[model samples]
Target: MIAETVTAFNERWWNNFLESTNVLKKTNVFHNCMQKQETASMREDVMKIIRLIAINNIPEFGFRLYIEGKNIASKELSSFFENFTPGNDEKFEEWSERAFGDKKFGIIINRGEKFNPTLVEKIAKKITPLTEKVGIPRLGVTFTIFIGNYGWTPLGIHTDGLGENVMHFHLGKGGKTMYTWDVETYEKIVEPANRFNNTKIEEILDKANVFDFEDGDIYFMPYGEYHVGKSDELSIGLTLWFNNHTESALAKKLIDSLLFNNLEESYEILPMDTSPYYDFENFEDVKKLFHNNFGDKNFLTLLESTYRDYKMALYSNAGFWEPPFPKAEKIDHNLNFKIKIKEPFKIIYYSDSDSLLNLFIRGKKISLINNSSIIDLIKKLNSGEQLQKETVFNTLDISWNLDIKKYVLDIFFENHIIIVDYA
Candidate 1:
């Protein structure tokens, strides 16, 4: 089962979550599976060390590393980060001995799934479905692990970028303690837009509220909050960075209008005014002239014709030209099974008349055929209605059309949409 935040973030909680600066949860998403990975990948483990140095122009009050309950001074980070030797086991042993053995703390910056080893990859797969269920965009989390016998954040107070975060003390014998200040107090201590002012730390230490997340505790930090933490004992933390995905419909509309336009059925280049007055410097000008003079008047009318003659089906991989699925050996539908759409997929369509229509599934257009006959079929499949075997025989009324089946199979291989036995 997936874990829940303290407030159970429904639509009603959006106002409070957004309006408030920082709210603390009662516990972290405590789990036992990630412990083995605590010492797993060294390269992934030490990824963020250099980013914490003061010379990086990063302000003192930013997401940074800490020792066992204390912050590492900026000047000391240089000598500390020199231990790792890229790709040499001998150098690594020498480095780890000096870095972990001498300095005693390690820094890792988990940017994304790019470095996902066995453990982090599994955690990502688990959380993806839960996010989808809650309408959250599936841009998975970043896993930054802190490894040390003693841990305290030397990064000082900081606010992460715009997104929610899950700080899980997934493995450790010690406990995690966090202190957060409301936005107002943080802004007063460090200028909202400027953190280089050498602000006194005493200002922030005064107004903060403290909380703790022991083993298995999961704390959800909503966006735009200032916080810092400390931990005792050998500990490993997996920080899951999450945020809503926002896409502007207008941008898509504009691109579609431009890429897909009305064109004349017959193409004949019009005579151009070669008087040098038509000279242009931009690509947009050439595009306008080309479309106006040689483009079709009803380009959409050619859509079906293009499909009929096309050798391969077009599967949308969001502009990725990956190979289309192999064609089925044969098309036969005398089966006795009812049909249903696959889980995690949705079929959507828009039609002027049954004969001319556009069908989309999982953000990809599946416009292989243009006919009113299949409209009923599309509706029934989307509605989760089970069809009788007779419908499959008919292939139009209670049945799904063969062409639809073929195209769906191509995409089903991609898992964009699927066909399944009726539940």
Candidate 2:
């Protein structure tokens, strides 16, 4: 039998996980500030290139995609699409020939070097504060992209079964298909015992779901959910998949703590693999193992408590939103912008006399905030108005020298702290 009542299991598995993990940090705040700061200076059309990485739980579908029509229908990509198919079938070539018939490559920049330098500059400007605020090793965002033309819709309802998290962002119309199971139900469905063992395609497809997704909308489906996608249009989208082992060290530590605290006859060690262990047939045995290992009262207790703590961590983190602001050359602070932290702590201050800001982390002097005018610039930036050098200089009560104004604004432009609009 399952360890708890459906209600109890639901409490432990799905809702709790969702409530706990979705959070945006000061870095996120700073990212927003930076994005706003540069919005005016960057080319108008280029700003749409911004993609948020947090919405999806799956690492595979984590990053955003900005594709143009020409690139989607390009010869090189078309050839690649033709040469490769999702299921390694001949149909890929057949589909590829039709999709690429006459279309020329559009200007598509998949970030990094391939993207226009100006566009990159604008993005980097916005992205910097968030990265710095979050204390992530690097400010650059990374996610996978799978852009191909699947002309026909094939209904082979399959679960990723990889035991890793994934998020699907469907670009074209055929519609998504699935019967989303809540975590407990999902876990049970994919459990060693009830896995659609040797089920026929027709049988599984009957239980599948179909849904719609437009250009910017995103969906968050956590790990272990069974679903599929079919597109009637010339379909293209990005699927973010994380190979197992992406969970936080805190999560693992919590899990270990629970295991150690619970369990009747203490097992000597915990065995973990980055790959899914159960296959098609040995599920029952695996379920037996899970119950034997996890169903113990001690294990359950630890699971419950650690899950709560992790959930709390996520919930707390979610509430912390900091957008990156453009830094100004003037307005020095009593304490230096550069910080050195020996241990984790919160960095709290004021955006102004009335507004409060905070940054949380474990180490000291992670980096320097540097440019002094960033706070005032963020205030003006958040106003969502044009930020001319004169306007900034006047607001900060600084000397109206053109050379100084140009220098400060130049730094802002170079750092993507402010956006420029040519038109």
Error of 1 at 331 (Å): 14
Q: How much lDDT does each candidate structure score?
A: 0.46, 0.35
Model 1 accuracy (lDDT, Cα): 0.46
lDDT tens readout by residue for model 1, 116-209: 2234334534444445344432332455565554444655567666544554534444567777776787677677565422224455666877
Q: What is the TM-score (0 to 1) of candidate 1?
A: 0.43
Assess candidate 2 and give its lDDT.
0.35
Model 1: how far residue 390 lies from native, Å: 9.8
Best by TM-score: 1
Mark the regions of model 2 whose C-alpha exceeds 4 Å error after superposition. Answer: 1-146, 149-170, 173-203, 210-222, 238-247, 250-374, 394-407, 414-417
Steric clashes per prediction:
19, 43
Looking at model 1, residue 183 earns an lDDT score of: 76
Q: Which residue runs of candidate 1 sit more than 4 Å off their true CA positions?
A: 1-156, 162-178, 191-206, 214-218, 229-345, 352-360, 363-366, 371-404, 419-423
